[model samples]
Target: MTEILLPSDPEVRDRCARSMASKAFLTVWEGAVRSGKTVWALCAFALYATRSPDGDFLLSARTTATAETNCITGDYGLLSLFPGAEYRTVGNVRMVRFRTRQGEKRIHVVGASDIRSYMVIRGATFGGWLADEVNMHDRRFVSEALNRTAMSHDRRHMWTLNPDDPGHWIYSEYIDRYEAMDAGERAELGGFAHFWFRPSDNPAMTPAMLASLSRQYPEGTPFHTRYVLGMRCVAEGRVYPFFGPSCVAEPPEGVRAEFASIDFGSVHPTAMGWYGRSPDGAWWKVAEWGPTAEESARMTVADYMDVFERETERLGGIRRDRLTIDYGGGGEALVREAERRRWYPVNPDKSVLDGIQATAMVLSSGALRVSPSCRRTIDELSSYHWREGRGETVPDKVRDDFADETRYAVSTFIEPRIRRRRRWSRT
Candidate 1:
């Protein structure tokens, strides 16, 4: 095994100790992003695997790719804890084989994203399970996964995740119930232990890093409250609360790249935005266009294409690969038409919350700005809000065409560049 240098932070050390000592049926480390909870859980699981009963163990995340990245091959992942660990595939299942003090152990890695993913473990049994980002998994998959380990002599499960809505099934069904139970009650129902982690709990986070992360998710925003403080809160109020006068500016010269994004609609108004990225990595929304209700009602794919061409030419003709469009509703037809025209239009990532979060972070950091002439886009930015009275956190869809288009542009084009820049800076 490689030499491991543990941090000296008392709280972090205590959490690590608790993880290794936990005898509960379910051990959960829930908290903020970069809180080191996943590392702690993985370390604990590594210890458990050595002495665990002779049965298959499972390691899972929201997707198989994420499971492999975060658990098996990540910097502080399971394989890193075991020097000779190697991944192998048995049929459709992926497993990590490693020798421990007792004997060789095999742990299967799986994705628990889809509700139907439970079928993967339907007939299989596991001695224990380690699930990263468990809250993102479907409730059906989670329930079934826990049942898969019920027959094992050492039936333990470790889960780590960032905070979500208070009403999320993971919170209400497990965390809340575990917290509300008395000691006697908890003991009778099989032990459950929950550990809360904050960004400060991560020893690797320097003061400068914490300050930078804090600036990305400003205070008084849902992203800050949930991701920074590790609180279970629903997104409310304006989606782009930081999009004030400062976020509205004229386009800069010497642009490095330009792109356009569209939110297509036939009944509703179609919205399109032309965006440019400056050399310093800031994004500027240069122009926006939308058809009136009457025009949208009568417009065919060809008409829309004509308008797109005119707008593209007017805004200095963006490359075909830079075009992003929503792939739902009438947007699908628009994408096909763009392809037929020899333009390779890409579909934007439609994960609403993730896109919204990325957009908000850039806007808050002043890395994203919109032209004052794009009046409709600016209006949507200020008025976009979370839907109220909904059990889940959902952005209200009213008058959000321009907002969706902006999100598509920023998330599809700007976010990836921002991530690349950050990684480069780190290196």
Candidate 2:
């Protein structure tokens, strides 16, 4: 007979229970929406709380409402999985506490509206920490909440989150680095161990739920691909999936563009791409000139200045307010020197993903056109490949020089309002 009781799957429960007991620094459960990530998270911590002594467990979510709705407390009927537990509610504090016979475990369902709430975890030791929907949590939680556990021994931090694309902060910090490690990255032990599963991995899922999901979301849809299969498939990040060499743009004659972006490489060729906005609100990549044989022969700053002066004259006397440079080591000084020669020096706001997204939106919308003079930029954009596996692929360190330059190029000259934020603060 099928097990009709709540938390009926022993394998799922046992796997979660064992991971919590192992006290690994990071235990991630990447699963589909209905694959029982929440159930496994609670069962694991509750089971550990029952087995261990003098340790606390925290159940944190993006908000208190989600915490209550997701059944982190006994009121959600999920606590029925642990029949031997008693729940006490303190209405004044809006908190719920659970106790098992082996040892008492307190579950704090804290809301994260701001960074201040996370400060409470400082110097607080926990036997188990359950961060639900961790991807959706603010970026501040990592430095505040997780870092505070550095001094604790035998403590496990468990993450239960539905998979998001590469743009998310947690995916970049944890999952990205974990994948970058080589076979021998960890000595005497092994590489960081991670596990991913879907609702299909669990036999407990009902046929009705599967059919309902299929009917509600079509194949290839984000919801279906993300929530139903729990696969980390991000189609948006793969811009220009089928682009080829035919669409490369050529430089135009009678150039009136007054702005350019400079990527100064002292040893490498100092590179720059010139641009101008058309009447229809499209950006035209008019010219791209990097270190020629003559400019690359020397590493002196005067050599860079000479090349800059030539480009400035070639572009019909560049406006001193329109030049942008990468905020690299010693780049500010180069910009200052260029400014001394009456060329503008500018620096883009540092937002990698958002800036990339803005440039992509323009490119896909046909609002960005590349001139034939910018041949290397076009070639690099074409060859920029998405990293294999999942989440944000480490920008290829080798073949990504031109791609990186193009990203910086668009970030500097693309005057998109959404990408630019006006900062104002009250005194």
Candidate 3:
């Protein structure tokens, strides 16, 4: 026997209760991490299914794997979160077949990464729809998914996504544009509603944990702006909003380890960042050199190396082999130069999203900090943001040399160490 244990968070409860009682065609939950919105979504999905047992619902995510991980199978999985819930997948199809008060229910699972994925729902009709990471889906898929819904009055939708650049369609198309229109406009565009949340909304999160999480992202950083305060205030495209005053502390007195990260930018402005790791596992930006555009246009590998070595010495000395340079095609020359001089080649993790995500994760934990002197790094991170129109959000290539170098260094050096400690803690 399972029980539906909704969070006491009023916003979550009110939003979910609204979905259950209201006839609005769409209900969206947008907010910060651990806010219990997802739990609300699961409840709404189940309640909707029960009301129309003969109805078939459609559920999706960026991918089927993610759908399961985020909902059905993850630690806080929805399947087990509700009591007396039993489901069976329908054959080889992407659906979870179950029985509820209405009689028979089927919740179809699909991935909406591309337009082609829409074929999964082609010609079929849905009683309800639930989409996770809706922002990641192609517009065509989303449109098609909506079209596949059954015409019954019970048909409804629930969507969730983290905050992205304001330019994101989630804001322009859904939040303000599509919903909240006048009766005539909403009647023409379709009915919809939304709710907002933050980590503080989850009472299960202890005060100490919240403080630790708060420390990870100093105020004014994008992570803090979105995840902590739950405001859509971060500038549309800036990537590392976590590099401002709160994140910049005076150079710490005890730096347990030292290393350097280099992004070779001849003409584009090469960046070298000296980082120190303390016993507390925080990574600090101790020193950096991000030359002016004009200077980088002609600065040679040797010129940058001279500055790099001096910065290393000033930061209490890092082993020469630990000096890492980017090996991505654009930085090959620098990598070659470093190898020639016995320096380490920091193989750039080509997955731009992964590196950015890693950087954000570190910042959210307050483990990534910067020195006041590393103005270049701070400036770059402050402005680095996702570029729109690519069908995907990637950090704009411009004004990101130091940002890239810093992310590569942290993902390469700090994340691995953090993971090891986490693994050890379980034992």
Could you give candidate 1's per-residue lDDT for residues 266-330 as a string of tens digits? 66789988888777767888888898877877889889889999989987798888899888886
Best by lDDT: 1
Query: What overall lDDT, based on C-alpha atoms, would model 2 receive against the true structure?
Result: 0.60
- Candidate 1 vs candidate 3: which has greater TM-score? 1
Give a tens-digit lDDT track for model 2, residues 1-427. Answer: 1122244467655665555455445667787777766665665555555666644556677777777777544432335655544445555233445556654566655665356767756566555566778876667765566665544444556677777665656877776676666666632222344556667545566888677645443353344566777876664433444334444454344545667777766655566777776554556777777766674675566667786668767777667787778768567778777777766677764455445554554565455677766767776666665554554423343444445555676766664432352222211
lDDT tens string, model 3, 131-227? Answer: 9878778788888888888575567788887666566666776676766588887665557777776776665678887776676554654556666
Error of 1 at 385 (Å): 0.9
Ranking by lDDT: 1, 3, 2
TM-score, cand. 1: 0.95
Choose the strongest candidate by TM-score: 1
| Clashes, model 2 | 7
Q: In model 2, which regions exceed 4 Å deviation?
A: 1-231, 234-242, 245-247, 250-255, 342-344, 387-392, 418-427
Better of 2 and 3 by TM-score: 3
Q: How far does residue 387 in candidate 1 sit from its true spot (Å)? A: 1.9
Model 1 lowest lDDT segment of ten: 1-10
